[model samples]
Each structure stands twice: as structure tokens, then as C-alpha cells.
Target: MNFVKRAGTSLRARKARTVVLSGIFVVICTLLLGGFLLQAAAARQEADARRTIGVDVTVRGKGLGPAVADRLGRSAPVNRYNPVLPLKAEARGAQPLESDGPKPPGTRTGDRARHFLAVSGVRDSSMLLPFSYGSARITAGRGITPEDSGGQVAVVERRLAERNSLKVGDTVRVRSADHRRTVPLTIVGVFRDPTPDPPRWTPSHELPGNTLYTPVRVAQELGSDAAAVLSEAVFRIGSPEQAERLHAEAERLLGAGTFDFRVNDRAYRDQVRPIQQVGTFAGLIVWVIALAGALILALIVMLQVRERRDELGVLLAMGEKKRKLIGQHLVEVAAVALPAVAVAALAGQLAGQELGDALLDHRQGDVTPGQRQREPVAAGTPRAAVGPPAMDIGPVVLGKVAGIGLGISLVSTAVPGIGILRLHPRSILTHNE
Candidate 1:
């Protein structure tokens, strides 16, 4: 009989030993697979923390004005500037067609519905707070730019656009609430708000989702005489640590008479704190599992070889090559280990989620709500204010786990196999008794 065939039959015949060893392999494989998945998840979260959290400083005061916002943004360390001008308008060719919200009283069927829109004049509408928290996403066209300043262009919400049958380059005719001014707004972009109805207690602007974003210049030109009194400015910093320094510098450069200087680090902190915790926990667990898995598996394999010494001895004496005899031992362990690894992929997915969530939950309280951190957020994409949470453990993770698990098991089993397999067959047979 072939040595390999003989070894397979032996493993099947020794039910108790095979079961115990297989159980050990399953545990080791599960832990290793979970560790890899957590590590990948942690990496993705840490990488995206900054974008999901958002800008560092938000200066809101009456009449902060575009000039002031622009100047602060151009500050030595500041990367992006957002100027906000709020407007209320009765918009036509802008409201969504599907009627869901309470229509204005006395409205006839087939008539174009008008809405009380909370229009904003922002340098980049994509940088607006709605997009930061994922309440709104820009789904069509391009965002407002500096070159589009003073130009009559607008990006409307998706629901609003669909209701009115509008698309990029279409016109949205906005009339000021008082009817004193009207701007023929051209639709350059469209946005979508997934929430059909926010809580009744929520602000009107956040609920009905009738938001229109226009260039600051056009906003400034069309915004009412009192518009400047309510305008605010937002400035982006490279990291949260720079907020205070930049705030001080901005205050010194432009005296803080009209605007109240406030550092908006809470959002960045809240989103990043848990993500970072997951990363740190994964780092620690990976080293621990690697060492423990290797040591335990190697010790088990060594003991198994000692127990089966007579079998190895007889095979060696029967003219079977030592290499073939050792190969049979390896093949038996691999037979058990291969199935353990296969089963581990399923367990790892569920375990990874639990481990990450648990770690994130535990570490969340590490950083106080008001405390400052120094995480970095790359400032390149003008519109991608916040990155959505990433799912990293999929097909790629499974492939890696399988390959690494097999290699680790092989190494762990090989280390002990080598030590005892070097002994002479006659000495092995005598020691077995």
C-alpha cells in the first residue's frame, strides 16, 4: 500500500485523536482568519476617518461674508474655504414633481407647484453639511466653483429636480420670498436626500429637503439687503490640531467683531475615534494570535509525532524512504487542517464584525467628546467631504486568509515534525515501547 494511503487510513482509524487534532486546527484557523479580517477593516476605517468626519473650523456669525471666509481659507495652513449664504425663495422649475409633502393650500392639479426652499449660496455646495453626514449626496452634474462665481448657476436637490423635471443645464426660476427680486437660475447639478421625511421636530430646511446651492457671487448679488447679517464661513484645516492656531491667526488677521470664532472639531473627533480604536485593537490582536497559534500548533504536532513513533519506525524499516514517511505525517495533519481553514472563512466574517464592533465600542470612550486629536485628512477632493464607511473583508480577504492559514499551519506542523523525524528508525521503535 502507498505510504500516503496508509497514513490516510490511520488517521480515519484513530477517531479520538483525529477529532481532537481537527478541533485544534479549526480553532487556530478561526483565530488567524478573524485577525486578518479585523486588520483589513481597521485599515480601511483609519484611512477614511478624516473625510467622513469633515472640516476643522466653522466660523458662524452675522455677516461673516464671503470675503472674510475666502481670506481665512487662503490662510497659510488652511486648505479649503466654504462661505454660506442662506436664502428663502418660492422656487418654480425647481420643486420635485412627485407630491409627498403637504402641498400649499389652494393649489390646482396640473399646476407647477411652488415650494418654500431654503436656498444656500455656497462656494462649493458639495461641502455643505448635508453631504458631510451622508444625509445628502450630489448625484448629478458638477458642483459650484470659483470660476462660476457671479454666474447665474445652481445645483438643486434630487427630489426637487425630479419633481420639476430638471437636469443639468436646465433652468430653475427662483423668486425671492418678498417678490422684490427674481433670478433665472440654471441647474448645473442635482443632489439627492434619501430620507423621505425627517422628524417633525427637525428643522424645515433639513426635512422637506428643498435645498438649492448657488455660487456665492450670485448669492451675494441676489441675497436680500439683510442677507449679509446671517452669512457664515467654514474653513478647512489639514488636521484638528491646527484649528486653534489657525483660529487665532485668522482672528488676528481679521478682527473678530462680526463673526464668532468656533472650532468645529467634534464631528471629526466623533467619526474618527471609533475607527482608530478598531485599528489599534486589530494591531494588538494580530501579534498575539500569530505567536500563540504557531506555538500551540507546533507543540501539538510534536506530541502527535512522538505518540505515532512506532508507525513511523515500521514504515522506515520496511524500505520506505524517510521523506515518504514524514510526508505521510504531514499529509495526515494537512487533511485535518485543510478542512479547518475552509470552515474558518465563514466564522471569520461573523467574528470579524463582532470583534471590530466590540473594539470600537470599548475604545470609543477613550477620547473625551471635547478633546482634540491630530489625525490627518487628505484635502484633495473638493466635493467628497466625507467618505462612506468601507467594507474591506470580502473575496480578497478570504483568499488571503486561506493562503496565509495554510502556510502558517504548515510551518507550525513542520517545525516539530523536523525535530523528531531526524531520529533513527531503530531508536524510534525502541523509544515507542
Candidate 2:
């Protein structure tokens, strides 16, 4: 009879053994598949979590030099840079415009006071500090761009514009606090400040209600501080991990004592913590699942070899080569295992998601609120499902599970097959050494 036919005959004759062996594989495949899926989910969570936090850093120190912004801007972690020069601008002939000169002696609380435009020259609308933080929003015209920093272009607050009768394309006269410097500013944009009213203790002159924005170069000229220097450079990083790595590199470049890095990664850290825990658990699960599957399969196969010692002796005595005998045994096991493994693939995927979510939930304590804002995970959308806590079973996940299952099968089969290699036909058939 052909080896394949003989193997089939052997499998059919030992139906009980086949059932037991196949059942073992079914469980093994399920666990492996679940672990793989869970790991994939955790990785995806980590990536999504990082995106929302956004990499923002503020570099502070003395004598930062002009090129510091350029160098830090090109760093691997930086998404962009926002250079700014804040100043108190002087306005003349404008109603309610903050007075530039010192308060007159004995000015009473009920006395009419003036407020100045909180002038800030910025590299770009996007790079400006207050604008980037959403504290001030432009509602009319356009903000001053890089090209307008020193050309007398200005973006004034909407309330400030209303009080001064200023409109887009109109010119307003501004003088420095020393009253010795003055410039003509053309209105280009109007913005609204949504910040809540300051406490009663805060003075009206301190309000940002009548602020102006210009190019950074303009603000520098406006101050004309004999010793003025760029105090700090702010860089928006790309990711939290890169932020940390780049911080070290930046510290070296900027020098430890000369500068300090303030990275904003609180949201990213909180969001990723739970997913990181899941990843750690998944790693351990993989090892345990593979080892457990291998041990059980090997033990069962070893017992099958011992029980068939007499049959093996007969086959060996009948001129069958040891190698061919082993091949037959392998064929028998495969015949039973292949079908069991195929079913296990489906069974494992069905169970992987629910189990994975349970693990995620156990680890998902109070993280950052941003994690909850994750895009709604939908079922049949792609790799994820629409269920609570998000469970996904995709082709990639199944492929990984299948690969791991195949590995376990080979390891379990080969280790026990060694027992047959040690057997001697004469010792078994004649019951003699």
C-alpha cells in the first residue's frame, strides 16, 4: 500500500486518538490567534494616541542666538517653529487706546484710563504664540504674514479697531513708549479675543482687548532695546518618542546650562499607557501560548509513539526503512492536524477580539481624556470592529496567527518524533534487549 494510504488507514483506525490530538490543536490555534490580534490592536492604539497629542516644545535660555530657531526647526522631532517678539506698542490720536506716558500723579480709580495695543511681531500667523494657543482668533481680513513683519502692516483686535475707527487697508500712527520713535501701521486684519474677563483686581490697561500683531522684525525695531536678544525658540515636535530623543540632542547643541527644554507630552503619555500595558501582556501571552501548545502536542505524540512500538517493530522487520516509517507517522499526524488547524483559524479569530477587548478594559483605567476622543472605531470599516472598546480581526492578524500555529505544530511534532528514532525493532518484537 502507498504511504499516504497507509497513513490514512492508521488515522481512521485510531479515531479516538485523532479526535484528542485535533482537539488539542484547536485550542492552541485559538489562543495564538487571539494573542496576535490583541498585539496588533495595541500597536494601532499607540500610533493613534501619539498623533492627537502633537509634539510641542518650548526652548528657553540666554544668548540663544539668531540661528537657534533655524537649527531647532530642522531637527527630526520638530514639526515647525513659531518665532515671536512681544512688545507694548504706543498709539496716538486713538480713543480708548492705552496712553503711552506714565500715569499722572494721584490718578483716582474712577479716572478715565487708556489701554495700549499688545503688539507682537511674529514670523507667521501659524507661528505666533497667542494665535497658536487659540486665545486670539482672527475674524476679519488676514493676519500679517512673514512678508509684512517690517513693512508697517498690522493686525489689530476687532474691539480695538472699533474704538479707533480703523478698517482694513487704513493707516494708524503709533509711537514708542519713549515718545522718540514712531511708525505708521496699515491695518491688515482684525481678531477677537475670546479670553474671559480678567478678575476685578486686574486693571483695564493690562487687558489684551486693544492688541496689535505684526511681523517679528517690526517688533524688534519697535523695541530697539540696545541689548535686545531672542529670548526663546519654540518648536513643535512630531511625536513623543522623537521629542525625548531630540531633547537630548538639542540639549547638547544648545548646551546644558545655556538652555532648557519644555516638552508638552502629557496627553500622549496618558493615552498610551494603557495600550502599552496591553502590549506588555500580549508579549507574555505569545510565549506562554506557544510553549503550552508545544508541550501538550509533544506529550501526546510521544505517548502515541510508545503505544505503537510493537507495530513499528513489525514494520521495521518487514523491510520498511526507519526513515520511511517516520514519514508515515508524520503523514498520519498531518492528516489529522491540517483540518483541525484550519478550523482553529476561524475559531481563534472569532474568540480573539472579545478576549482582547477584555484585556484592554482591564488595563484601561483613567488615562488622558484625549484617548476617549479617538475616532469612532467602526465595524467592517477596515481592521477594527464597531463593538464597545474596539475589537478587530483582520487578514494580517489571521496571517500572524497562522504562522505561529504552523511553527508550534512543527516544533511539537519534531520533538516527539525523536522518540521513534531511538527505537530498535528487535528489542520491541522479541521483548529482548
Which of the numbered candidates is closest to the native, going by highest TM-score?
2
lDDT of 2 at 71: 72
Runs in model 2 deviating more than 4 A are 54-56, 65-67, 90-115, 120-195, 199-205, 208-231, 238-256, 263-265, 335-399, 430-433
Per residue, candidate 1 scores C-alpha lDDT tens digits across 1-433 of 7878987898889989889978887887787677677677666655555533444576876546677677677887676667888876667544433334554566565543334677788876545655543456668887787677769999877776766778998887878767777889888888787767643333334545577788876666666664364366767665577777777766675676755776666555665566666667766776676677667777877887777778777777877787776677677777887788778876765566666665544233222221222232432222222333333467776676566556666777678767655867888767765
Tens-place lDDT digits, model 2, residues 1-433? 5777888898889898888877877777777666777787777766654543455677777756445666777777765566656666667766544444455567664554444456776656644545544446678888776566458888887777887778898988767656667788788888888765454433344666667777666676677583345656666564666777767767777777677777765434454576788888887998998888878877877787778889888887887777777678667766655676568667755676677667765242222222221121231111111123345666776666666666666676687667777777888888832
lDDT of each: 0.66, 0.65
Alpha carbon deviation, residue 201, candidate 2 (Å): 7.0
lDDT winner among the candidates? 1
Candidate 1, residue 4: Cα displacement in angstroms equals 3.2
TM-score of 2: 0.68
